[model samples]
Target: MTETDPVTAAPSGKGLDARLVVRRGSFRLDVELSAAPGDVVALLGPNGAGKTTALRALAGLTPLSEGGRLWLDGVRLDRTPPESRPVGVVFQDYLLFPHLSALDNIAFGPRCRGVPKAEARTQAAAWLERMGLAEFAGTRPRRLSGGQAQRVAVARALATRPRLLLLDEPLAALDARTRLDVRAQLRHHLADFEAVAVLVTHDPLDAMVLADRLVVVEDGRVVQEGGPSDIARGPRTDYIAQLVGLNLYRGEAEGHTVRLEAGPAITTTERLDGPVFVAFPPGAVTLHRDRPSGSSARNLWQCRVAGLETHGDQIRVDLTGELPLAADLTTVATAELGLRPGSSVWATVKAAQTHAYPA
Candidate 1:
């Protein structure tokens, strides 16, 4: 696509714009991405979904396919070498040099880019101060805490003043408590950054919280792209719906009823026509030991309990029968219903609980 094309164009004449294509035997990844300066877009997907491949392509670590292209700040970078490209990468493990002090590690990038040792050290010191890591300047990567090392890695990336910043699971290395604090700090730093940033992650919470926009890649292609709330409320693919904790199905809709392609029809509050997607949260489903004859719910089905697992404080029961779906219930309710695998049960959901949108 041309630079001016609405689908793949960055805002105005600058920022990031590219189509990344990579072929590895039978697997091919073709994904188009665009972002304005100061925008942070997350490449989110499941394992082996090419999120890392896309990030590597952007950093020039992976060669693009014959038809692929890369651009940043209106400058073409298709043939640029990794060391020559104005890109900074923060790897999953942080990749700090164990032998070097934190400050020296941060200075390495600037030093490699032709800056004098003293000047590079000065810049690195400033970055450490900015990232609140000046106190750990003399400490080696082995001595720094996970959160401290992460901030140091980010400082090291920023010390070179790159035009494009790429983070591959930047927060994935920290523990739960550390991740919470570091994620907030990272968000603050990213807000202050003016260059384009692309983050690759499988964590929906990370992508939704840290990114200004989300580009969901699945099976080597862009399945959906939009604001966090938009994608959360209206997921287009089963993967996305599952990521956002919603059960989804594609079907033909006529008025309030949607005839699913693979299962029973669903009744929704929306009166849509043509092909559509029906979605509802697992919590929307109510289960019963036997069918309720006087139920007010318009949608009901006789289902068999396929599986049961604890989801946080509630029990999530997987059902299979006329309609395959999931239901969430409290532990007390689960025991009261005497639910178990192979047990027969009835599931019901109000029409208002289901959402239907055009496919």
Candidate 2:
């Protein structure tokens, strides 16, 4: 599939439109992705899903077996080698040389690009200061903390002044506490980069927080691609639904009636026709011990509780019966009902709470 630039008539500034296909024995990876200038797109997937392989292909480290098309700002890049590609790559490990200081690490790229030694050092110094690493400019990678090393990696990548920036798990090596601080800073840096930035990450929060759109990969293929809110609200696959934590259903809608594939019908406030998506977060679901005789709840289910797990102060109950659905309950209510793995329960959901939209 070809992805034409959305800003077709306008001048190509800092954007990437590329198609890659890599095959090795039995495993094959095909990716067709594009982003506008200043757009951050996240390539998200589980481990060994070829997310990293896709990034390497963009960087010219991996050869494409079928398609080798690459364009940056309307300029053909398919013939460009790794060193020749106007791209910056930040590895998962923040692969800085142990022999070099932070300043030297950032300077290395520009120097190799034929910039004067004095100018390269000056450029590197500016980047280090911008990244708040001036104090550690003289420090080696072995001496820097995980967060510091990551910032240095980004600074080094940006020093190359690339038109297309590729980041592979930029924050994966950081500790949990460091990740929060780094995430905010990284977002700010990406916005001001004036270039198309692509990030590969397995963490859902990382993708959602850093990217404008997400291209979800599964088993070496692009399965889903859309805006962050769109992906979160209507995850197409079970893996995606669990990643974003939303209940998703596929059904045909006529007016307000939605017939589920699993033999349960739901009525919603939304008015739509044809194939549609109905979604509700687990927290929106409420549980009851018994179905009310004349209840206001539009949707009711007599389900058996299959499992209960504590999620902080809330209890998440897994149920099976008419339809398998997850519901969130308070710890107090769970104990009040003496809820267990095999307890009988009733689930009530309001039509207004459920969202129904065209698929």
Best by lDDT: 1
Please, what are the lDDT tens digits per residue for candidate 2 over residues 20-72? 78897788898888889899999998888899989998998988775557778
lDDT of 1 by residue, 3-110 (tens): 666434444587888999999999899999988989999999989999999999999888999778788887778788999999999999999999999999999999
Give candidate 1 misplaced runs (Cα > 4 Å): 1-12
Report clashes for each candidate as comma-separated counts: 0, 0
**TM-score to true structure, per model:** 0.95, 0.91
Candidate 1 lowest-lDDT run of ten: 3-12
Work out how many backbone clashes candidate 2 has.
0
- TM-score of candidate 1 relative to the true fold: 0.95
Look at candidate 1 and give me any clashing residue pairs. Answer: none
Every candidate's lDDT: 0.92, 0.87
